[model samples]
Target: MKNDFEEKMADIMIGEAVTALLDEGVAIGWAVLTERLRLAIENETDENRVRAGLRAIEEVRREMHTRASERTGLPRVEDRSAHKLH
Candidate 1:
């Protein structure tokens, strides 16, 4: 169960990410959005909020890919970072 603060953070982060994705279209990739969300949450002091924000980011990205792929009848492209040696 998420606390109020964590839930609030997830809402804020997910809302912003969805807005950006919708405004910019599906060309935005996972790495770019993840980097933006990471920067947004970098200074957050609460670990729970930070974790929630990251999870929200992933949720938005996955949904974006699913929707876009469905609309375009194209396969979802995997994130480049997924193949990289991190």
Candidate 2:
């Protein structure tokens, strides 16, 4: 079904983004990572899928920061009143 295909594609995209994060570390900023992924899927003609991919990237980044903060005993940047996601 179309729903199943979309879910799988999102999962794959998230996995690739996670790999990129692990491989590149602090060097890959959120904007750069999103742009890199946008380029990777530039051939994807569906606007909806492209938007979904962007959402997935944001979600992955949020999850990463959340987990990191949990393990490090530091507040996530989002938790800081003065700082926000870059």
Candidate 3:
């Protein structure tokens, strides 16, 4: 029973860590997309389309930051390099 409980708790913690990783990945993806969108806007000739793309990217970025903040319990990256896989 003791071993079983330990295994279960380990699984739970692993699940939480995985969730955090996925969440952080989403934020990273948003940052990458934001950079791309900025470049696209600059290259595009139409001002209205550029503005629309910028707005959409900003909204996605806002949500990503918010969710990452809540999940990590830190406004910025809580840890730059740290992960255990086994």
What lDDT does the true structure give each of the candidates?
0.74, 0.72, 0.56
TM-score per model over all chains: 0.50, 0.50, 0.46
lDDT of 3 by residue, 35-80 (tens): 6556655786765555565565655567688788889786544343
Who wins the lDDT comparison? Answer: 1
Task: List residue ranges in candidate 2 displaced over 4 A.
Answer: 1-40, 82-86
Q: Give the per-residue lDDT of model 2 (tens digit) for 1-86.
A: 76666667777776786587778774666666766677656787887677668666666678778888999999887788656567
Which one is best on TM-score? 1
Better of 1 and 2 by lDDT: 1
lDDT of 1 at 39: 76
Per-prediction tally of clashes: 0, 0, 0
